[model samples]
Target: MFSPTGEIVADAQRRGVGVGAFNVITVEHAEAIVTGAEAAGVAVILQISENAVRFHDGRLAPIAAAARCVAELSSVPVGLHLDHVESDELFDQAAANGFGSAMYDASKRDYEGNVAATAAAAQRGHAQGLWIESELGEVGGKDGAHAPGVRTDPGEAAAYVAATGVDALAVAVGSSHAMTTRDARLDHALIEQLREATPVPLVLHGSSGVGDDDLRKAVAAGIVKINIGTALNIAFTGAIRRELAVQTSVDPRRYLRPARDEMAATVTRALRVVTLL
Candidate 1:
């Protein structure tokens, strides 16, 4: 029963360091995350997204509750997070489900609109004793635009946090969502500038696209939370695909066990890179 209580993020912020926030799509993913974190001796965040919730028939409570259960059972500190959420309704649902933190993404809207919506979401999240994370620039591949080159304005980001009162801010610095490759190049100077400009901790979204060395550099430059989704998915799915292709008549657990182990190793690699351990 080791919930994070924002200790990881707070510690990172206080020391100008970083923590990893990986998205959990299934029980296997949850198990892998906790396993990896304990092995590395570092705290981590387990996040569930809105699209993932939709896939489970609009019921966030069960999955969120499951994530909380995973967090509680882990040996290392964990925080259950809702990733890239857009609606006030779902935001409320996350708090009720016992999420410790969440990211409210309104980057598709105009800057002012994003501020208003994120601020409202923050207000609701804070009321429930939950932490709020908001994004600045839109991560590409969601609306089919694929604007991976967009960078968040340091000045605008500072203003956005002041307006929204978010605990963390995800800013664009050359990472795109759902990337299958780790070729993304981050703006290290921009990250340092943002750290100076904003009061809250900086989160790097679409971090699966970032290579290991660059990820460590980003963290050293003041990124406190790194959000990873596609990398673990790739590991999980690839392991399963490889296993299923080899044996058609095997039990599901036999395949899923390796899948979970592979994903846990992937998470361990990621934590090592970003946490610099």
Candidate 2:
């Protein structure tokens, strides 16, 4: 059944588990996430990023429709999220496009500018009955929170949430995006500190780099929503590459099936850490 992002997140919070929010680049990605969710018997989020909208030719309606259908058809609970949204127009499309929640990314702006922009975005989201999430500047390696030595302050995070009225905050402790290696160290004490200091649920971006043991520890420390992208991409792309190297047929279906299955397996394993661990 389709679930509310807030409900899933709140439930995860109450249970001391991290809710996995998997990024959906294609409908296949959404399908695989749901399959993994069902296998784990957990409610998972399917996230469509602003870049993904552009990749679908600057129209969110089609991708949104497909992802929504995938979520609606899932046997397990699933929620749709618009992730890393930088444009106000895109944020405006969240509710209209069937997204239950959105992450307004104004972290590239100056601190005050981020606050102002994110605050306005949060207001719009709240008025539309959408759960809104925001980050405190860059957190790690890529665009969606990854830079060396940059970490969110507990005081500033609390203030940002208060200033923006966002439902959740993505803070950097130690993790980089697009990391193939799963050895990124995390600051569990800082996570606990932030959890204590901030009123809303805590989110962790660029978590693909975090190892399984560390991921479990982070959730235990107080991370509610964990964003994972690179890991799924790795599984999907690697499977496709291997299939193409051996197969004579050029049909996309033949390759994509294995690719999607590989991603599903990766998702199930990752979900187990946050859920069953």
Model 1, span 1-277: residue lDDT tens: 6575477799867765578899888888899998988888888999999988988898898888888998898888898899888867898887778888888889889988999898988998889888889889866755553454467888998888899999989888877788898898888998999999998888888899889989999998989899888888888888889998889866899789988998899889898888887
Model 1, 182: alpha-carbon shift in Å?
A: 0.8
How do all models score by TM-score?
0.96, 0.97
lDDT of residue 9 for candidate 2: 96
What tens digits encode model 2's per-residue C-alpha lDDT throughout 19-59?
A: 99999999899999999988988899999998888898899
lDDT of each: 0.85, 0.90
- Show model 2 residue runs off by greater than 4 Å: 143-149
Whose TM-score is greatest here?
2
